[model samples]
Target: MLELASNLGQAPKAEDLSKSPLSIRGLTVSYGQKPAVFSVDMTVEAGKMTAIIGPNGAGKSTMLKAALGIVPPVSGQVQVFGRSLDEQRARIAYVPQRASVDWDFPTRVIDVVLMGLYRELGLMGRVRAKHRATAMDCLARVGMGDFADRQIGQLSGGQQQRVFLARSLAQGADLYLLDEPFAGVDAATEKAIISVLKSLREAGKTVVVVHHDLATVNDYFDNVFLINTRKVAEGPVAEAFTAETLQNAYGGRLATAQVDQLAKALA
Candidate 1:
């Protein structure tokens, strides 16, 4: 969430939206001399799911990475809950793309989910029975309880995603960020993930996703952050996910048939 604030902690004007879980201002990132994201700004609507949508290589993933400091930006500032991100790390949970993971790491599903509890477990604490119970509950919520004892590398892509989602749930963070979670999953996995995310929003937790599926934007997200190496549009889905804003981000890259589908999807 990148609003041009004259003062960081000053009282916001009445016109400003409610609390922002994530905000960024003039965020610019470069890989070598090539720019990835350029002067982007955003303010995530609290308690809602915001989707970062754009064409391929449009800096969608890079923007999230920069916000979380996974990749340093060329120049920018990121804040979470009106505070520095470093000050609010425990309040946020992130799920990266499955392709970026090492599937052969030989970790068990339950162990992976338990990693979310490291903060609660502290530096030298051992996992107690209560911790295992919490981890199992999280896996059950994602429909993977039966596989808790299974090896992570043996699971299918969709199953692995569900396990990771379970891990995120076990974190019990107030804000969640996911990068292309539905990219390679089956329809069932997509449905399961969206269902859980919507539940999180209903519980008043803020969620942001680097989403690639344009067809589901209107149905799944409350807000949209459209970008293409720059801020194309940002606001509620009804306002920012419009045909005009989408066309502005995608330009002539979308086929006519695809445009028709987007029309029906947003209608």
Candidate 2:
């Protein structure tokens, strides 16, 4: 139940924690000559579920990529746990969109999950028994323990997402950057994923997700960052999930008549 202003004040003021588990200031991203994200500033708390919601071309995914250092920012800075990306690499995990990977490649679910530990394995290293155990544990966390030997291409869209979730789990990170984790997932799979994310938050891991469905935003996240090229609004769900805010986010494109009717029904 915190506002953006209050949350900024409540955050640790020291340079050490003030840098945040994930922090962005005046962040912007450009693909060639076109700017995808405009100047934006935000902070993600440790052990909380934060959702970034916006329409297509709103730069939600771009902001996430910038945070992960996947897309270099044209301006501003991103700091993780008070350190630069290189220093904080081990403490962060990323679950990219399911469509981002080459599913046609022949690989087992466990093999993909084990890739999370490759950073620790070093170059030209083989998976050891300990790594196998860790990967199994991660699969179990996502309810995919029995599918360890299953081929990645054979899994359903939901199952594929769980596999990636397991991979992030295997990384043993304190911060998770998930891009569209719910896309194309069934309701049951979506609920299961939400449960896992809640558990992660309970375990003191920061989770930042790029989510598109506006109807489920309140139910799914503790904090919401409403973005459309820029940050329109951000804070706890109740305060930021207002008609005026939604209108601002959607602009004149919203069906005002339908919204009025819905508001009257609720009233």
Candidate 3:
């Protein structure tokens, strides 16, 4: 059996740092000369769900990528569960935007999910019956069990998302980072996905998502990290998801009515 946390060979932690699931300091990302996200510092709450919200091009996705070492940043340090991200790779799971995937690739749903267990399977590609059963169970958890043998390109957008979530589930990771999981899906799919995420939180896992819908922020998340090229305000929904902070991040783009609705959501 795999250990939940890999042996990083680091000395003991100083109490508070060990409790932080994800931490980024002085994170800076750039697209050519322009900075995408700059000087951002965020510490995610353990055993909770957090949303990274900002207006278009505010670096919500970029920040996440940088922290995960997916997209290289100008400068930064990211720690996962009180250790360097590289030192704790197996403890993390990531799901990129659905649009970023290449559905046309010739592969069945099960193969994609099997990628999650690469570390466990090792070089000889020995996938035992137990591995197949574990993959199916993960698919079942995300409502994709029956589609394991189906072609990847044949599934609808929502179904595609669920399969990917199943893939992430197979990782058995302690921290999950998602990039706009709800971007283009229908309502029912969104509901199903959030239920799975909420269950993870209840089971002592940490989740961070790049979220766009302001209306559902309060209903769906325990904490919010608002950014617009830099950190705006980050804390619980009641504290950070406010009219003033919304204005600061979105400028005049967010309507007065939406801002008022956000205020009422906290009431």
Lowest summed lDDT over 10 consecutive residues: which window, candidate 2? 1-10
Quick one: best lDDT, which candidate? Answer: 1
Residues 44-103, candidate 2, lDDT per residue (tens digit)? Answer: 766778898877888999888876778888886777776666766999999999999899
Residue-level lDDT tens digits of model 3 in 159-221: 888888888899999999999999888898899899999999999999999999988998899
lDDT of each: 0.89, 0.83, 0.88
Model 2 gets an lDDT of 0.83
Predictions ranked by TM-score, top down? 1, 3, 2
In the predicted model 2, the residue pairs found to clash are none
**Considering TM-score, which of the candidate structures 2 and 3 is the better prediction for this target?**
3
Worst 10 residues of 1 by lDDT: 1-10
Error of 1 at 168 (Å): 0.8
Q: Write the per-residue lDDT of candidate 1 for residues 122-181, one digit (tens) a residue.
A: 899999999999999999988999999898999999999999899999999999999999
